[model samples]
Structures are given as C-alpha cells and as structure tokens.
Target: MPINLPNNQARDDVLAGRPALWLNPNLKQDGIWDTKLPVRPSRVSEAESNWMLIASLLEKCFPELKATGGKIESALIEVSPMREALGYSSSEFGRIFVKADNDLPVAGSIQARGGVYEVFMYAKALAESQGIISSEKEVDRLVSEEANALFSKHTIAVGSTGNLSLSVGIAARALGFQAVVHICSEAKDWKVDRLTRLGVKVVRHNADYSGAIDLARAQAEADINTYFIDNERSQTLFFGYSAAANELASQLSKAHITVDDNHPLFVYLPCGIGGAPGGASYGLKAIFGNAAHTFFVEPVQSPSALVHMMSGSSEQVSVYDAGMNNKTEADAIAVPRMSEFVAEVMKPLLSGVFTVVDDDLFRWLWIAQTQQSIRLEPSATAGFAGPKFIVNSPQGHAYLEQHGLREKIANATHVVWTTGGAFVPEEQFTKFMERGASLVKDS
Candidate 1:
C-alpha cells in the first residue's frame, strides 16, 4: 500500500519539519470503547494489582518510594500561573492542569509508569514461574538473596532514546537483574552516563530509535536468558502505562472536577514512539468515553505518530520516507518511526496530533519554570501548545463545532501531560534555562 496522506500541504509541512496539526479522520465516537483492544482497560486494573504486590520490594530498593509506600505516581497540579503566562484566559482555554510526570518518583520521568512497571511485572512473573515466591505473601522474598541469585542469571533489555532507558535500567538493577540498554545516537550523554553508573551495559547505536530497538530485539532473541522489552509491540509496557489513567481519574474526582457532556476533558500527551501517549489515551477513552478528547504532541522534525497515522496506513512508515531528518533538541522523542501497534490501536481512539517547534518548546519551558516553578525538558514542554491549538486554531474550531463542543468550551478541562526533566543534571538544566530565557527574550 502507498503512503496516502490526506493533503499535500501536511505532507510538505511534515517533511520540511514545520509545525502542523493532523486530525484523525477515522476517529470513532462509537465502538472505540471496546475492551477487547490489544491492551484493554481491565489489564490496567491487573497492572495496578501487580504494582501493589511488589510494593514492599520497591520500597526496600528505592528510597524515593519509601514516602509513597512504593506507589509510582505523580501529581495532577493546577497550572494557573503558567496558564496565565501563556496569555490564555480561563474562558478561552478553560482550566489548565499539568500532569506532572516529570517529578515522578524513581525514574523521574513518565517512563516510570511504563518502563518500571514492565520490569516489575517481568520480575514477579519470573519469580512465580520459578517457584521462588508462590504466593502474594511471599512476594517480598524477591529482594532476598535466593531471588536475587535467580534474577542475576537473567537480563532485562530495552532500547530508548533516553528516559525509558533510565527507568528500565534503574528498576532492573534494583531487582538484581543484569540490565542492558541499547541507546540511539540522539540519546543524551547524561542519560547514558546515569545508566552506566548503575552498572547497566550501554550499547550505543549510530542509528535512530527504531534502529536501536531492532538491533536490541534481534540480540535479545539470540540469548534465551535475555528478555527484550519491546516498546513497539509490548502489551505489558502498554498496560503499565494505562494504569496511570486510573490514577488521573481519582485525582480529577478528588479535585472536584467534573468531566461530562457540558464539562468536557481534553488531555494532551507528549508522544515518542507513541506507547506512553497511546496507552494513556486508550485508558482515558475507556474511563471518560467521548467526554475525553486526547491529543498527542510531537516534535516538528520527529512527528512519527502524526505522519504514520495521518497516512492512514497499517504498514509502518518512517519520517525519513517523508524526508524528515528526525533530529531535534527533544532528544527523548526523536524517533524516526512510530510503533505500528500503537498506530493501529489509536486509529479510532485518538482525536488528533499536533507538532511543535523546538523553539516553542524552549519558550514554554521558560514560562513553566519562571511562572510556576515547573522544570521540564524540551520534549516535555511540547504539550503546552495543545490548549492553544484546540482553542485558537481554525481546525480546532471546526472539530469543536462538529462535535457540538463549541458551546462547551468554557467548561472544558485541559491537562498538559509533562513527560520528563526531574533527573536532568544541574548543568544541563542550567543550559536549558539559558536557552529558554534567550528564546523568550527574542520572542
């Protein structure tokens, strides 16, 4: 099948690395809430249960988890100050909140939700299969010497541009499992150094994220003792991310927020290969149904999910095929291609995707830091553009009118899911702040 995009303009804009918004024409209001998808909402409950089972082990291993009793979660904070700084009043963009995954415990990034959960799930399964801990009561024995020895005989592997590697490597090493991270060239030196310091083997790749993942998967397949956490097709990883929706639902309820027909909910997630955002969108749709509209944010040069989904093709497509260089300051999400599994799952669920330039990301980063004291990396700030696109753009107005949401604009709730930055080194963070300040001044 050919890559048939809806418009030549969008194709050209994407190829030229110019920011663009691509809405999903295949988005369905009905039947998209099906529980039989590749990763179901019910699996989210199971993932939550699994997290509880390993709570004790996580607490023993990671000091950060001690305060939360081993629960991997982040705050849903109201960013009124930051929202005002963006120059949008309440009536135009509604109440804005930031899903602060940047400050998540342990991994200090959104990958803590998926990458850490996947590692924990694998360890629990391996222990149970080997009769090391047959019951939930004995699950704490996973940290014991006997279980450590068994875990030492095996390895957990993943390929990432940055954050996922940190989450997976940190969790795997904590459980005494040998960890191997195949990192792409775009991955930051700080992330690589962090992983190496944790005693994890770092395999550097000269290619992009997809290439690193391919080589990692192939290498892991040859070694029976090694388990590859495939970001492209792993249901475990997807389910791990889906559980965050449940957390968000609870938070919304506690905050006296109402998400209904009149008071709609809009969530903007920063996307990479699409696993994190796709899983979160799926879970959100399952809980809030048509009331929740989810959008994915991507770098202008690395809009892998946008390009592939916009093409309306099941066949995997790369940004390179569209003449994109896939280079961006948002290193973590500089993916050449998206996860095919995620594209298929999001076909009917995703509302749309929008691209952001690196400069805007820097400007938003500066605003977030100065106004609300929120520290975020370039990739994480991509979601800040979501509310403006939804409220101010012509395409956005059309979508709202089509969905009868034009009258409901004032009552909407918007959440910008920030992905990472907590673990950014002080010097690197200073550099980010400087660049952001310069960009803000020039703007």
Candidate 2:
C-alpha cells in the first residue's frame, strides 16, 4: 500500500489504483486568504442570503430548528481524552475542538448545511415564481397547502453517496417537492431506506459517485422542471457551506478563543468533491486571514482534491489520472475527481493536504469512541489523522516554519470537522465499531 510516486510519475501510479499523499507546490502566499471578504461575495455574501432562507425554511418546516429559534448549528466540544490518546500534547498542540457536524440535527451531517440550502434554493424559486409566497412577511407560510401544491409540480434531484441525499431529500420532502436521490452503490443501505421511508425517490446506480451524478444530471436536463443539485459544480452549495464560518466565528468569540497572529486556528476538513471543505476553508480564511491554517484530509484511494490542486490547472483532473481506482471504506469521500471550480477557489487557500488509509480510519474511529465517546462513521474519522499527519510530515514542519507559526503552535486551536453519522442505525454503527475495534487490536 506504500505509494512512492515522484513528480510526473504520480499521474501514472494514480491511474493504476495506487494511493498518494500529494502536496501542492504551486501554492501562492497571496494576501487573498487574508481578505475580510471577497469583492462580489458570491461565495460568502450569497451564503448569508441563503442562511436567511434556511432560517425561514426551518421555522416553517423542521420543528427541531424551530424549537432552537430557527437556528441550525452544532456543538464544538473539547475531546481532551482523544487528543491525548492521539499523542498530541495540550501544551504543544493547544486545544483540540471537534466541530460536531456529525451530530447536527435533521440530516445529521455537514451536508445539512449545503444540501438543505440547495433544496431551499430551488423550493424558494419555485414557490415564488408560482406566487405561493409573496414576500418575506409570508415566509412562515412555506409549509402551507398552496406552497406544497406548487412544489409538487417540480422535483429536486441530487446524486450523493449518502449524507447529502438525506439532507436534500428531507428538505425537499418537507416543502412538498418530489425528492429524487440518485445514490451510488457504495452508499449504505440504511441511508437509502431512510430516504425511502421519508417518501423520497431513491434511485440506485451500480457505478461510483461520479457516475450517479452524471446520470442524475442527464435525467434532470431532459426535464425542465427538475433541478439537479450538482455536487461537483454548484455555487449555491458552496455558499451554503461557507456560512459555517460565521457560526464558528461566533462560537469561538463566545468561548473567548483568540484567532490572531499569536494564536492561529487550524481546521482539518475531510474532502469529497471538495465543496464542503473548500467552502469552509475559504470562509475561515476570510474571517481569520492568515491566522487560519486550513488542511484537507482525504482517503488514500481518493485524494482527488489534493491531486487537482497539486496539478495547478484550470482543467478537470481525477485521482485516476495517477492510477487510483478510488476505492475506500469512506464511501462519502470516495469521489474519483475533485470539483474544478472548488479546486480553483481553494488553490491559494488550503495550507496543505494529506491522505489517510482505511486502516487508520478504522483505528481512529475506535479510539475516538472508546476514549472520547465520539462515535463517527468511517468517513467522518478521516479528519482525526490530520493533526498527526501535519505534526509528523516534513511538508507540514516546513509549512509551520514558513508561516512563522512554529512558536505559535502552543496557542493554536485545531478543529477537526466531523462530517456525518448522527442518524446512523444502531446495527450499522455497531458493525462499524466492531470492524474498527478489530483493526485496532490487529494493529
């Protein structure tokens, strides 16, 4: 399983089904990451716009967020036990907080951010166009029969491994839109069944995530009334994901955590098609400037984003370009290719990227639950290795020195964004736990 691809040979090895840990050498230290806000705000500002719609939708549709005053946010907890178990010193690595998006309400994943937002976007447009709701004052009427009737005429379609489909389907069904989730074969059966139980149409494909998306896109294009939530190239999804930064900023401020020159903030996000992590990184950089050091974690078999960014191209690229067949237990992040748009957006922003094998994912999953009571799906455990990877790698040490962050390591706060698994069936979770535990014992 050892990957030793050097330079141009990486493309060949990746195509042959080998895994790699690729670092971007064309990284630019431009002051863009430090900018308070991008000029157009298409990514950040529109995200705020969508956030308001999310609030409205939640207020009228989901009773849970309504109970919480229409706010959609998750916990940022300190897992000192897990941190210590990972051999990260509190004195040297500062505090470690797990942004528990895995336990998020409703769909229970990071996809709850963008996935639901995209659904709401399509719903809002349809409802407004049909005169179902006239103004902001009438937003609460989104759950009305009139709105539902208008929505039933159209459909919201998306291709997902699991979590994103749950969010999209849940949101779409809530507003009376016909939810169609085209899922890859690797997605969990429980997820598909759950969506089906909610009256969402579950279309199964034997191909991978990309194949499912391509099929869904084709189907949606054939019908004008169908809106495809394109995971690979959706600006709406990107904006929705970016809104997390504002929420995190408020949480950090409330906890009296300083994110500045002397106290850096490091975020490790697990990457799939790159929208979630890419948008999150962009927003963090916008908020904290250079003080925010963002890294993306990928499964070794599908380090698509890393490969794309390393190539430094505007054209599309796939992990298969280097011989990777894109197979991993982390189904949610098993995408073969990265989003070109997201890659371009994240090019100058990401501090580094690394890969963790499936064995490590299982080991970390067991460790997290047994030691910290933080149970995560296999894919969610991908970020757990981020801190260790950076601390041990030559590239990471050099990055710290280059950024003048060597001395500031003690004050740095590392946040591993847990992406999914709150609603995983007990049976399925137990199986994952058992597999992880067995792997840990063997290792």
lDDT of each: 0.89, 0.80
Summarize candidate 1's per-residue lDDT along 1-443 as a digit string, tens digits: 24667765556667667777777888888777563456556776787788787788889999878888989889999988766678776677889999999899999899988998899889888999999988889988889899999999999999999899999999999999999999999999999999999999999998889999999999999999999999999988887898889899999999999999899999999999999998888888878989999999998888889889988776888888667788899998899899999998888889999999999988998899899888899999898888888888777887799789998898999999999999999899989999999988987
Clash counts for all predictions? 0, 9
TM-score of 1: 0.97
Candidates in order, TM-scores: namely 0.97, 0.93
The C-alpha RMSD in Å for every predicted model, in order, reads 1.5, 3.2
lDDT of 2 at 367: 83
Q: Native-vs-model 1 lDDT?
A: 0.89
The candidate scoring highest on TM-score is: 1
Give stretches of model 2 more than 4 Å off. 1-21, 33-39
